[model samples]
Target: MGLRIPVKLKHNDKEVEVNALLNTGFETDEPVVALPLTIASQLNLTPGEKRFYLGPGALVGEVYLAGEVTITVKVGESERSIKAYAVIEPREEEIILSDRAIAELGIVVDLKHMKWWLV
Candidate 1:
């Protein structure tokens, strides 16, 4: 039901690889990504601010903005990196790629064929 991309996150010299789903509905002013609390713990990320997350349907709750995180992804033949805010959701098990993040990464998603490529 969504586009998934490989994501590499680095924080405090700790690096981990995970798959993030591209969420077109996620509208944010900054380029950000949402990570599970467990994964954030692995990166030793620090919380910044409290925010509310609205999920599919009526699911809505509070989440912590887990400071700054480095997101690295390969675009075309080159690798790109950007700093993004990480929202830590204790109950979330999947990584979400926000629209801002997608713009920064230059990822092109083909919804008609259900595929994605780096531009």
Candidate 2:
């Protein structure tokens, strides 16, 4: 297990709390949050006109842009909310937070201890 933290996502007046993976390798200049189709549906998000092909190494399939959502990350007494582009992945099973998202959330990851904390 890596740095998985509880996060609350809100959009279209709908909200859901989930454990999101803090993927340092998911590099992006803009704040992005990748969610499974089920989670996107839960937040009442619909795929937009924009789509992109993404994968760990090679292109696996296409993912759709689901607009933006407010992501609230809380650890202990530290909490923050930021707008992030939501990407819906049909093949994804877990929520993956991009590097930008982690930075915006002020999370400090300790890989050695397999722990994370808000800074």
Candidate 3:
């Protein structure tokens, strides 16, 4: 279920880092991560889990946690990291790099024209 991206969350103020796996299949798909409510509240997340609305009356709840961290991802000769929410998919137990990791590893996504861009 955690078939998405891997993000690294770093907090300069807290001096801590949390590498999290992100999945877009969550019900709410709010770009939030999987974490307890107690932790989520501290990050100023919504009340309880988020509710997702699909159809006219379809609704589903999602699990999310809020934590301040930075997302490190390598692009070229230098390393690139972005400030983002380190979210995970609930019911997902392990963390692994999806196709997204290839990008961070300095591999080209467009193999046709950009095959020589690997660094």
Candidate 4:
């Protein structure tokens, strides 16, 4: 298992704080944050472009990047805006913060203590 932390997401005037797992498996240039359909709906996001995602064990799935927006995430004492690819999927249990997000947020994963902290 990977490190997970509580993150705050903001879009426009709407905001929601949820638990997000640092997804080490995701490799991409931009930060991608997977949100549930409910949360995405709350943010009033619309699908823009269709995209495909390949997960562990070759779990291939479809996603959309149509709702391109700048979302803010609160790390420790600072907040950073990231251009995130939103995934409005139905069955996801937790939000996923991709590697790019991890680095941008300066999140240090301390596996030995099973903890994560911002630098």
Best by lDDT: 2
Query: 1 or 3: which has the higher TM-score?
Result: 1
Tens-digit lDDT track of model 3 for 29-116: 2233354443333344444334433433565445343443444554355565534443433544543333343344443444334222
Q: What's the TM-score of each model vs. the native?
A: 0.88, 0.91, 0.38, 0.81
Clashes of each: 0, 0, 6, 2
For model 4, what is the alpha-carbon lDDT of residue 71? 51
The candidate with the higher TM-score, 2 or 4, is 2
- In the range 18-71, model 4's lDDT, one tens digit per residue, is 778888777768877877777787788766667777777979987666465455
lDDT of 4 at 92: 72
Each prediction's whole-model lDDT (CA):
0.85, 0.89, 0.39, 0.72
TM-score of 4: 0.81
List RMSD in Å for every model shown.
1.9, 1.5, 7.5, 2.2
Give the per-residue lDDT digits (tens) of candidate 2, residues 1-119: 66788899999789999999999988889999999989999999987765765668785576788999999987667789999999997888999999999999888999999888788
Candidate 1 per-residue C-alpha lDDT over 17-111 given as tens digits, one digit per residue, 9 for 90 to 100: 99889987888889988889888988998666888877789988888988888999875677888899888977779989889998888778887
Looking at model 3, report the run of 10 residues with the lowest lDDT sum: 23-32
What TM-score does model 3 achieve against the real structure?
0.38
Residue 49 accuracy (lDDT) in model 2:
63
Local error of candidate 2 at residue 102 (angstroms): 0.4
